[model samples]
Target: MTKYRLFTPGPVEIPERVLAAMAKTDVHHRTKEFMQIFSSTAEKFRQLVDSEHSPLFLACTGTGALEAALINSAQEGELCLYVSAGKFGERWGKIARRAGIEGVPIEANWGDSPALSKVRETCAAHPEAKVFCIQHCETSTGVLHPIEEIIPMVREECPSALIIVDSISSITTSSLSQRKLGIDILICAAQKALQLPPGLTILGLSNRAAERIQEGSPHSLYFDLKHELKNQAEGSSSWTPAIAHILGLGEVCQMIEEEGLDHMIERHNRLSKLCRFGLTQLGCTPVAEEYPANSLTPATPPEGIDAEVLRKKLQNTFHVLIAGGQDHWSGKYFRVGHMGSFSEADMRMFLGVLYDALSEMEAKLPEKAEFETSLCSFV
Candidate 1:
């Protein structure tokens, strides 16, 4: 099998040590050995999010955590406000509606951040909204929502609202602190910047959110936050946990600690800047110019050129996997993920592959000599 480097978002390249950690003999979940690992891993997660309350680990994806947040916080008769700037952001409302909760939409065009004043206006208009859902980074458009500014505005209008954040792709790559940001619930998955495989969702919940979960009954047996919390307190999962992923996660956390969270975040920012610069040289305009995410960069190809076609060419010929746009932006743009374990050399290698692939396609690109010279500064 051909070894392809992943430049697509989610499931980014895993560190060798983390991959090796997963190969350790699996222990029974009920055993003290597993509990020790679980406890340590939980503390690492809290430190990553800067949360005082221990996070709830779910044996599912980020979307599962999002649903749990809604099911535990929003009641049937109460209003749930949703501010969506991209596909994943809109998913909050979709999940809310599926859970039989009323969602008040505060929609913005993809790649555009919703104005804080407008969001404040929406909050004021929907004072009854008890739950507010936002995304720290919209993976689909590479748009980083201004969570810090928006949170204060929302709190001023609805002081008691449960602010739920979907930071699946942003957690380690960007600056997101659940406690410092006053975020009630923050959702993350192992696959993104955590440098682990899928199947494990890390959820950071505030004390207030925990109280709400304790007060309410869960709508889902599988995603029962209260039951999971009880199991977590006992240093286990409600169901059989993904042992390999958790073990790998512990190693990833150790790597993060050794490297320092601030350094990891800086690396992501550098990679994102390099990606945007290289894409621009190749005649692609970044989708989110104003507030692009450090996790990834979505670039739109020049008109009349299909981004999906270019993505396929790069994958087939260069064995580089860059993702195409989703929903309405499908075929119109491509995305390059710079999160998790991607070194400066690795980034340059992907850019070189991209340059070669675009050259072969006869795409309108900047002079190869100049482009490479510019890329070297970041590398």
Candidate 2:
């Protein structure tokens, strides 16, 4: 297969070491050796979110983890509140509604952050809400919510509410501490900032969340948090595990630990800023005006250029695969992923190929397209 460097929001580039780990000899999930691997991987995974080490690992996408979090945290006829700022944020309400829970949407413009006053108002109105859902970084718009501020405010307003943070695309790309922020449930996956192929969903929980699951009905066997906690605490999954993904996750965690979490966050932030700078130099407009996510950046093509056309051109002409928009913004903007395995050198490569593609398109060029290409700060 031809190797096309991918810049999609999730499933970012995989490191060679992680790939090697996944390709190594497979182990039986029921064996003591596999249990040690599972238990060790779970510990490392929780540290990524700065949470206590006892997170649940499920062989599913971020959506499935979100579902598991919602169903297991809240019961039927319970009140659930969520922010509807982008594609993933909208999922919270949809999931709640599907679960027969009363879901309230705290609406916001797609690329804008949710208003703090509005969120506080929602908390006041729905004081009985079982769980309040919000995405740390909405991948579709690349908008990073002020969770550090929002979480504290929500905690103060709705003391009884269980706050659920979907950090799927934001974990390693951005900085967050689940315990410090008082988050009840934190969900992430192997694909995004973990630098691994999709399959594993890691959910970090607090003691309160575990108690809720113990007293409440999860409604499903596979996603039952109570059962998973009891079994996984003993180094076993309730069902079949994704052996390769677990192994890859262990390698990724080790890599991040060695690199230092603070340094990794700085690297992703540098790359994300550099990507936006390069895009702006090419006469493009970044989608997120405020609090943009470090994981990826969404931008509109230079004036008069179709986003889809540019995305395909980048893929076909340059062998660089970027992503187009979803839902109402489809064909309106394109996104570039710079999280996980992407490094300073990769960001430079992205700038070069993007410049080449735009030059071939003969798109109206910026009068003075000046952006930093210096790696001095990066090193």
Candidate 3:
């Protein structure tokens, strides 16, 4: 039997050690052992993101954490600026709207990073905007926004606005330091760059963000960060937690510490460079030019080549899974993820398979040359 490999952005392959850790017998959530695991994992999360203040953990998806940040930071009917460049970015707008907040979307074309100037102009126009929400890495288009540049502009222009970032894919893949970046709320999930399975979400809240929650908002229940913090202070979750996932997360944290956070990010950078180089040599153009995502790369399909068909062939024939584009780009582009539980060898194999699939579809590609170029680029 052949083993299947996952190359999608979320639900990336889990490390064997992490899987083994999850296989352990379930422990009582109230026990000291569980709390120890929780505390240790929280510390590692802070170290990984280089946050001075620790983040809170929730047994939820990345979207749940995002909602938590939105609900806690801003009040109903308040102006919220959403910098939307892709699907996930648009989701932020949708979430804000659902929460009864007035969401003003700053639109950017898909495959394009959000412009700092545009964000600044929006803030200046809507001085009443209480929360500025943006995705650090837009997974759909594989575009990395200029958060570092935009953050300062927001800080200078709208000092009262809290910066909420969805760093789900960029947490470990890119060089991100939440505190240093001046982000008030940073939301991430274990299923992305953390190399763990879904079921755990983390929110690194700045003191300013906590104070905003205390000031009051209509957002309540299930995702209230303030309530979660109170429960976490006593070493517990407000709701029943996923014990096995927490155990797996503990092991993942150990692996991350052992590898060193900076080194891990550097590794991801190297792998992303290789993937981009290989894709370019294959005559496939990347979606984003200015700031391509470090975790995943979305490649536009060659003329007359159906990306969805190619993606299906890659999975069915080669036992490799790749993600298809979402929303408007659906079937037009496909994504190759190089984050979490993936190594240089895995990337080489994936690229080779992609080359073979494209060649079979009559898309002339410089397979051997591109592979060599990718290797040289990585080195």
lDDT of 3 at 138: 91
Superposed Cα deviation of residue 294, candidate 1 (Å): 0.3
CA lDDT for candidate 3: 0.84
Per-residue error for 173 in candidate 1, Å, reads 0.9
Tens digit per residue, CA lDDT, model 2, 167-224: 9989988888999989999998888998888899888988888888788786687888
For candidate 1, the clash count comes to 0
Candidate 1 lDDT, tens digit per residue, 217-268? 7578888778888889889988998888889888988898899999999999
List, residue by residue over 150-260, the lDDT tens digit for candidate 3: 889888778889999999999878888888999888888888888888889888878787778767645577877667777776768888877788788778878877888
Query: Which portions of model 3 miss their true places by more than 4 Å?
Result: 1-3, 367-378
Global lDDT of each candidate: 0.87, 0.87, 0.84
TM-score of each: 0.97, 0.96, 0.95
Which pairs of residues clash in candidate 1, taking residues 3 or more apart in a chain or in different chains? Answer: none
Residue 216 of model 2: what lDDT? Answer: 77
